[model samples]
Target: MRSVAITGTRATGHRPPDEYGAIFSAYLRPFADGHFYIGGAKGIDSLALLWLAGNSAAHLTVVVPGTVLHQPTEAQQAIARTRERIQDVVELGAAELDTPAYHARNRWMVDHASMTIGFPHADEPEGGTWQTLNYTAEQGKPRLIVPV
Candidate 1:
């Protein structure tokens, strides 16, 4: 199965706001059968996880900087409840959870996927999302940006 990596900003909240939800839903509709790889972070990552749990038939793999317990409470709960639906949960070694850990996780996702979907702020234009998309470009992977 093809895999699509999801990378985005952490500013969207646990549940995406209305506008973001619309964009996210639209962007994900075509990937119903694709495997989703996401960093188990607080904002966009958790929002994507919840969206997939409710809308898509795709398998999900959450790549974490540390243990699942290290994720935001909302993400942890969602993963626990939907454990059966998820295909895999990858936890990085403890030493990898520092400032650069999120970048590492992003690279892991990008390396494993065929394409990447990103939600980035055009104004701010910098963060993990930007870094991941840059990596995706360097790897010559296709990218779909959902402007937020």
Candidate 2:
């Protein structure tokens, strides 16, 4: 089966809910039959999880740098709301929630997935979403970039 790793910015305040819903419907719907590995954070992660859970039959895996409790309240609530739909939750169990830990979690997801779909807000060279997309490129995996 096709498997995908999703990466995006945590800041998604600029857009309205309907815009995101439309974006997800167009981009994520094509891959709805595949398994998805999400970051389990705010922004695109939580939004994608919510949309996928409600709209698709894909196997969902929510991965975190730490535990779900350590994530933002919004992310936790998203996970809780979609608990039944999610097939798994992978907690890396990192004590320090730093950039390295997050990168590791991203890499872990990318390593397991056949491709990656990134929704970066801008052309940020140092952004985590960009980093994951770059890493996927380095690993010789396919990537679909969708700027939000």
Candidate 3:
């Protein structure tokens, strides 16, 4: 099966209720048989993970910057429930939630996947999500941007 990486903004301030889950499911449906690669961050990452846990048959690999402990409480709960289904948990030994480490983790996801699915904010043109999308394009990988 192919691998598809998921990346998006960490901010949930403007996300409408249930919108993220709907968008994530729609974007992921095409890759239902593929493995999913995601950084276990809050916001979109956690939302995607929860959606995948309930909706897809795909294998999951959560690539964390440091440890699972660093994840948001809700994400940690979701991971615990879906622990049996996860194929791998890659801890990249990041000392903290620094920009460089997150960027490195994003690159790792983009490099490993056949394509990337992103939830990006058009207004914010220079964040990690945008950088990951740019990297995906630079790598010549297929990318799908779910408009929020």
Candidate 4:
């Protein structure tokens, strides 16, 4: 099956659990039949990785913003477990933690997938989720937005 990239807000305090579950099962599962592309971050990126973990046929590529295990956090450590469980994981390191490089990572994710799913928060324009969505739209790729 074709590959798809998943993107969304990191700060997801407003998202209801049921809503995320429905979004994952309904919007994420079909694309995750085989190889799937996910940026290495929290919230929806991590959630998609978690769901895709159960699908043995699925391959996951986690395009990261910095060096592998570069900016490790508690959440990222948890994601590292899921990453280890997956068949594949791709790390695209940024030279530094600059806005340009971070946005570049998002663009790279868009270029690799024909489809993207984004959960956008109204407040953050420079956020990775919004940036990824915008990049996908600019490329005219199919995109789904889960509103905040």
Candidate 5:
């Protein structure tokens, strides 16, 4: 499987829906032919999951740092909205939902996938998103960096 791990920011309110649609179309469409490992968070994760669910036939996996119920209501709702289309929901079952737990989740995805694509907020540089990208690079895999 051509697995791709997608890591991005949770803040996407700056762009309109149409703009994000176009961005996904241009950057994510080509990679949508295979399986995807997406963090089950708000913003890019939820957006890309919905887009791929509707627009492609790829297998989708949503990986959460903890149980789905532990996530924010919005994230849980997003997963619920597209439950039928998702192929897997991986809950790492971390006791505490913190930065390290999230970083561990990101590392898990990178370890499972061959490539990574990150959509970081333009101004932001350090976080789980960037850490994921760095791990991907450390693995000597291809990485597509797109700042939104």
Candidate 6:
């Protein structure tokens, strides 16, 4: 089982079909049933979690920045419910209403995983996704970029 960390923009507002397709094609295809570590958040993270939950992979871990229950968002709540079924979700810190120390949380994700798959070009100013990718690169970690 190869553990790969997934990250991306939460506000890119560009959830194109190809992006999800690429995730399955480029990342999930090569690995066996239970071999991915999904860093959970909104947008891309939620999508990845939902896909894996239905696919029946028992090794999926949803890593969140804070208490998953308190992370308020319709998509997040829905994902959280599905995530409970998976049984490997982890939270890194106390509950945060906003994105407090979120970038640091991203860095933690990158540091722990062997590789990171993300959408670094989906947004501007190099947000959490970019920081994570950059951190992984500096540490000589591998990366697979998802389409925007």
Local distance difference test scores for all models? 0.84, 0.95, 0.86, 0.73, 0.93, 0.68
In model 4, residue pairs whose N, Cα or C atoms come closer than 3 Å (at least 3 residues apart or on different chains), thus clashing, are none
Model 2, C-alpha of 144: deviation from truth (Å):
0.3
**Most accurate candidate by lDDT:** 2
**Tens digit of lDDT per residue, candidate 4, span 21-79?**
77678777777665777767776677667777754457778777886576447347647
Off by over 4 Å in 5: none
Error of 2 at 97 (Å): 0.5
Model 6: residues with Cα > 4 Å off, grouped in runs: 16-19, 32-34, 56-58, 95-100, 121-125
Cα TM-score per model? 0.90, 0.98, 0.92, 0.83, 0.98, 0.79
Worst 10 residues of 3 by lDDT: 17-26
Identify the runs in model 3 with alpha carbons over 4 angstroms from their true place: none
Poorest stretch of ten by lDDT in candidate 2: 121-130
Per-residue C-alpha lDDT of model 5 across residues 8-120, encoded as one tens digit per residue: 99999999988888988998899888999999999999898888888889999999999999988878988999999999999999999999999999999999999999999
Q: Between prediction 2 and prediction 6, which has the larger TM-score?
A: 2
Which is the better candidate, 1 or 2, if ranked by lDDT?
2
Clashing pairs in 6: none
lDDT of 3 by residue, 83-106 (tens): 888889998989978999999999
Give the number of colliding residue pairs in candidate 4: 0
lDDT of 1 by residue, 1-148 (tens): 8899998877764343676668767998788688999888777887788788777889899999788988788778878877888889999855656768878888999999999999876665787898899999999999998867
lDDT of 6 by residue, 55-99 (tens): 555467767677676554845675656856656666787555455
- Model 5 residue-pair collision total: 0
Task: Give the C-alpha lDDT of model 3.
Answer: 0.86
User: Candidate 1: how many backbone clashes?
Assistant: 0
The regions of model 2 sitting more than 4 angstroms off are: none
